[model samples]
Target chain A: MGKPKKLLNNPVDVVTELIDGLTAACGGDLRRLDGRNAVVRTEIADGKVALLIGGGSGHEPMFPGFVGPNLADGAPCGEVFAAPTPDLILDTLSAVDRGRGVLMVYGNYAGDNMNFDIAAELAEEVGIVTRTVRVWDDVAAAPLDRITDRRGIAGDFFVIKVAGGAAAELSDLDEVYRVAVKARDNTRSMGVALAAGSIPETGERTFELPEDEIEIGMGAHGEPGIARRKITDADAIAEEMTDRILADLPFSAGDEVALLVNNLGATTCMEMLIVARKVHHVLKARGIAVHRTDVGSFLTCQEMAGLSITLMKLDGELKRYLDMPARSFAYSRA
Target chain B: MGKPKKLLNNPVDVVTELIDGLTAACGGDLRRLDGRNAVVRTEIADGKVALLIGGGSGHEPMFPGFVGPNLADGAPCGEVFAAPTPDLILDTLSAVDRGRGVLMVYGNYAGDNMNFDIAAELAEEVGIVTRTVRVWDDVAAAPLDRITDRRGIAGDFFVIKVAGGAAAELSDLDEVYRVAVKARDNTRSMGVALAAGSIPETGERTFELPEDEIEIGMGAHGEPGIARRKITDADAIAEEMTDRILADLPFSAGDEVALLVNNLGATTCMEMLIVARKVHHVLKARGIAVHRTDVGSFLTCQEMAGLSITLMKLDGELKRYLDMPARSFAYSRA
Candidate 1:
C-alpha cells in the first residue's frame, strides 16, 4: 500500500468533525444548521437568490470552503465521496432560500443527481423556488456527442463560481441559473492521477495503478481514465492533457480563456507551475489569449498526487461573472 | 518513503519553469525581473515603501505567491530550500524600489540572514534605502532566552501580511519598518509532521519518522522538533501545540488574536479544520477572542503531510493593518 498515513480519528467521523472544525475556524462567516449536515453563510441577503452546492466530502473547498459571501450561500455536505441525502439537501435549500429562490449546483454524479432532484421537488412542495445545473465538463468521460453525459470534475469550480456571483447580483433565479448553464457549456477539463489517494476510514487506495505510471483523464474519485502508461515528462503530459481538453472545447485561435491548473491534492506547486508553463505554451501557440489563470488546490481528492486542467472559454457574459469579487474561505478575490 | 510521487521534468529546472509558468499564468498581475531571479507586481505605486519577501523555494505561496499589490510588492526567489544570492536580492531591490525604499523580510535562517544582510548593504551602496526583518517565531527551536535563534515557520505569513498592508498605507519606510517589527514580535507558531516529503531534485525524503507517529514542533524544512512519539488525537495534538505557542508568547486572557492553521503541504483541509477547531477552543477557553482565523495552506513544504499552527496577538493597530484589503496570486480579501 503506497497510501500515506493520515491524521484522522475514526475515518467514519471525518466529515462531521471536519464540518464542526470548519464552522469553528471560520470566525463568524459560516454556521451549521442544527443537527443537519448543512453549512451555510452566516448572513443571507434578504432578497438575493441563494446558491447551494454540494456532493461529497474529501473534495475540500468544493462544497464547504466555498460557502461564504460572494460564493455559495450554503453547502449541503455529504459523507466522504458520497452524495448528500435528499432530506439534507431539502433542509439546506429551505434554510438558505430567501424570497428570491435557490439554485442547486454540483458535480454531475449519479447519486448526486438523484438526491438533488428529489430535494428540489420537495422544496417546491413547500412553495420554495429552486433550479439546478449539474456540471458536466470532463471531456474524457464521454464523446462530444454525449457531452452532457460526461462526469463533472474540477470544472465544477467555474460553473459554481459563475452561479454564486450571479445569484448574489441577479434578482431572479432564472438569470442565475442561466449563467450557470452557460458557464458549464463553456468549460472543459482533463485530469491525470499519479497515485490513488486513500480513504481516511479504510486507509485504502481507491484504485491501483502501476508504479512509474500515471492515468490520464482519471476522474477525481478514482473513476476510469483514458489509459495508464509510463510516467512521461511534464511537458508531454501537459501537451496531451491540453490537446484533448482544447479540442473538446475547440477553443480556437483568438479565444480568451481563463485556465485553472488545479492540484488534485498533494502535487506540489513546483510541479504544477511547470505544467502551467506548458499549458500556456500550447494555448499561446494556437493564438489563444489567456485571461485569468489559477494554479492551486481549488478542488482536491484528499491527498491524491495528481492535477486537473480546466479551461473556461470566456465570452462577454462569462468573463463578467468570472471577474466579480467574492470572498469565501476557499476562493477569495479583492 | 511516505512522500508521495511528484510531477515534473528535469527536477533541476523546477524553479525556472515555476517562475516562467507563474509569469505567464498571472495574466498581467505579475512579472519577472529581466536577468534576475525575482518576481514582482507589474505595477508598483510610486513613492510607496516596497515590501520584498523571499527565502528557499518549495514553500509555495510564501516567497512568490504573496507578491502583489496588497501583499509583498516583490519576491526574490532562490533555489529550493536555499536562500537567494545577494546579487539576486540586490537586483530585486533595484527593480522594485519605487523611490521610498525596500524592506527585506523572510525567515531567520542562517543562509537567508547572511544573503539578505549582504543584499541590504549592496542596496545602500547603490543608493536604494533598505531595512530588514527576519522572522524568528518558532518556539520549539530555542528557549525564550534564545528566541532570536528560533527558526521561522508559518509565522512568516502573519509578519509579511502585516508588513505588506502597512507598506501600502503607511507614509514612509521607517513607519513600515516599525509596524513590521511590531507584527513580527507578536507572532508565534508550532508544527507537527506525520511523514517526510521529498525534494524533486533528489527525490529523497527530508527526514524519517515512524509511520504511526508524529514529530511535534518539526521545522518546515524537516528541521528537528521537540519530540517524536506515537500518533495522538487531533485535539490532544492541538492542545499541546497551542499550549506551547501560547505560553511562549504568554498570550493571556482578554487578548484578541489571529489564528492560522496551515497545512505544511499535503494535510487535508478536513484534518486542518478539525485541528482549527481545537486551536480555537484552546484560545477561547482562555478568554482570547480570535479576531480572524485562516485555515489552509499559506506556506508549504512540498508534499509533506503535516501542519503548523500560528497565532498573531493583535493590538488595535495590528488589527487595522491586517484588515486592510490586499490582493495577491494566492491571497485575496475583498
Candidate 2:
C-alpha cells in the first residue's frame, strides 16, 4: 500500500539480484553471458537455429524457464516489463549461436522491437543469420484487422512451443521462422484483471482499478485497457473473454484448436479451470474442437490478479509439435 | 459471494468430468482404470515396487499430474479434501500392483490415513503386500516435538519426488517405504493466506477474512490458520512464515537443506521469488547451506490467496533422488 521495504540492496539492484538468484537456482542447466543480463541453457546442441526470447523479469518461467530443450536457446531478461539493451541481446545470441543462425522472438512492444532490430543488425554484421517474429496475440491490445498492433500475452506459450519443437527437429532457419510465424498468426488472447500488482523495489502499483471492478482488456505491465466494469462470476467473465477471443479468431464449426488458459499472475488453478470450462462450452457452441488445453499460470504478470485465454488453430504440424515430449518447471508435453 | 450457478451437472459428476478431461488432455500418457477413478500412466513398466500415492481431489497436479514415467504408478483422486474410498484405493493397487508389491504414500490427514489403512488391510486379506508412509510437514498443524502430527501441505512435492525416483529405480518395497518416510520426516512446511478460496459447486468462500488481513497457517480446505494478521511488507511476511517453519524444524547452523517455496494458489513467480529470497537470506545468515531449491505453485488450494514453504534436511540419497530427472506438467528435475 505504501513504500514496500524489500529485503534487498536497493531498488536498482533488485533486477540483478533476482537474476543472480535465478542463475544460482538453475544449477548447471543455465548460463549467463559475461557482463550482460542474458541467459541460456547448456542443452543447446550443434547446428540448430537458436531461438532467443525475453523481455521483463517478473513473468518468469515464461522467457527464461522456457529456455531449455525444445524451447529457446537464450533469454535476455530486463527489469520488470522493461526492455533489455541491444547489447544484452547481442551477447545472448553470441553465447548460444552456432553455425545454424538464430531467431529472435518476443512480444510486440516498440522498445523490444527497436532493441531487437538493432541486435539483429549487429548479429548479421558478425556473419550470423537472424530473423525476428513479433508476437501479437492480445485481441484487446488492438482491433482484429490491425492484429500487428496487438500486444503479446500468454500466446507466447504457443510461439515458444512451435519454435522449440521446430528447432529440436533441426529444421532450417526458414522453416523454423515459418512455423513460428504460423503459430503466432493462429493465436488470439485476451485478459481480465481482478486486482493490481506492486513492483517490489518501488512498492508502486503498476496500475489502478476500482476494488469492485475489473479491467477486461488489461495488459501485462498494468497498461490501461478497453474498460473497467463490475466484477462478475468466473463463468461469465470466462464467457466474455472467450467470446471476444473466438470472434477475433473466427474459427468455424468443428475447427480443432489448442486452448491455453493462462494466469496473468496469481489466479488459481481452480479459477483457471473455471475459465477453462466456460471456454469449453463457448468453443463447443461454435462446433470448434479443442485438441489440447493448458490450464495454469504459464505466463504471469508479477502478482496481478488476472488471466488470459490464448487459442491457436491447430493443424497437423502444430498439433504434432504441441504434443511433442518436453519438460520444464512450468510446463510439459506428453 | 452468493450461491454459484450449477456450472456442473452435479457434485458427483465433477470428478468424472475432471477425470475425462485429465485423460483427454494427457495426450494418451495417462488413463483411468476402467469404471474407477484410479489413474495410471502408460509407461509404468512392471516389476517395480509400484509407488502409489494420492489424496483428495482439487489438488490437480499434485495427486494425478505427478503420475508418469519416472513417478508414481497410479493416483487415486478423492472429492475436495475428502479422502478416496478404500475400494478406490484397492482398485488402484490391483490395477498397477506387480509381484513386487506396492507402497502407499499420502498426507497425514485423518481421513486419508484411515482410508489408506483400511485399503492396506484389504490388500493383505487378498495376500497382497502393502505399506504406507504418512507425510506431515506443516509445523503450524502440530507441536515441534510431534512433527509427524502436523498436516501435509505442498511438501508432498519433495516426498513424491524422492519416492518416485526410488520406485523407478526398482527399489524394494522396504526401500521405497524408507525413502518416503525419510522425506516425510525431514520435511517441514508452513503457510500464510492472503485471501480465501471458493468451492466450485457452491461458489462459496471456504473461509473468510477481513479485506486488509490474512490468515496464517490455513489448510487447503479453507480452515482457520494459526493466526490472522494485517498484510505488510512481503519480506516481513515471508520472514514470519519462514521463521516459524525453521524454528519448528530446528535446523542447526551449517545444516544442509532443500527448500520448496510453494504457492498455495495464485501467488506469482515474482512474489514467490521474493519469498524465496527472504527465506534464503534467513537461512544463509545462519550458515545453513541450501543445497537445492524449488519455488513454484506445485500444490494449490484452489484459488486461495497464500503460499507454503517446505524445508527438507538433505543427504546424499535424498539429494540424488531429488535431483533425478522428472517430467510432469507442473514440475521437472531439470
Best TM-score among the predictions, by candidate number: 1
My TM-score estimates for the predictions, one after another, are 0.98, 0.84
Docking quality (DockQ) for each candidate: 0.74, 0.27
Winning model by DockQ: 1
**lDDT of candidate 2 over B1-334, digit per residue (tens):** 3222222345555666666656655557778888677688776676878988899887666787788766788899888768999999988987788778898888889999999999999999987799888888888887777866778888888999999888888558888888888888888888888766667656687877776677778877776679887777667777788778777767889789999888777566655665776788888887889887787777887666678888999889998888788765456454
Judge candidate 1 at residue A185 and give its lDDT.
92
At residue B58, give the lDDT of candidate 2.
74
* Worst window of 10 by summed lDDT in candidate 2 chain B: B1-10
Indicate the worst ten consecutive residues by lDDT in candidate 1 chain B: B1-10
Candidate 1 ranges beyond 4 A from true positions: none
Writing each residue's lDDT as its tens digit, candidate 2 over A1-334 gives 3322223345565566555555555657677667466778777777878999888777766787777777788899888778888988888988888788898889999999999999999999999899899999999988887888889888998998988888788659989899899999999999888876678656687877765778888988887888788776666787888888888878788789999878777565545555676788788888988887787777777667788888999899888888777755455454
Measured on C-alpha atoms, candidate 2 has an lDDT of 0.78
Measured by lDDT, the strongest candidate is 1
Q: DockQ for the candidate 2 complex?
A: 0.27
* Clash pairs, model 1 backbone: none
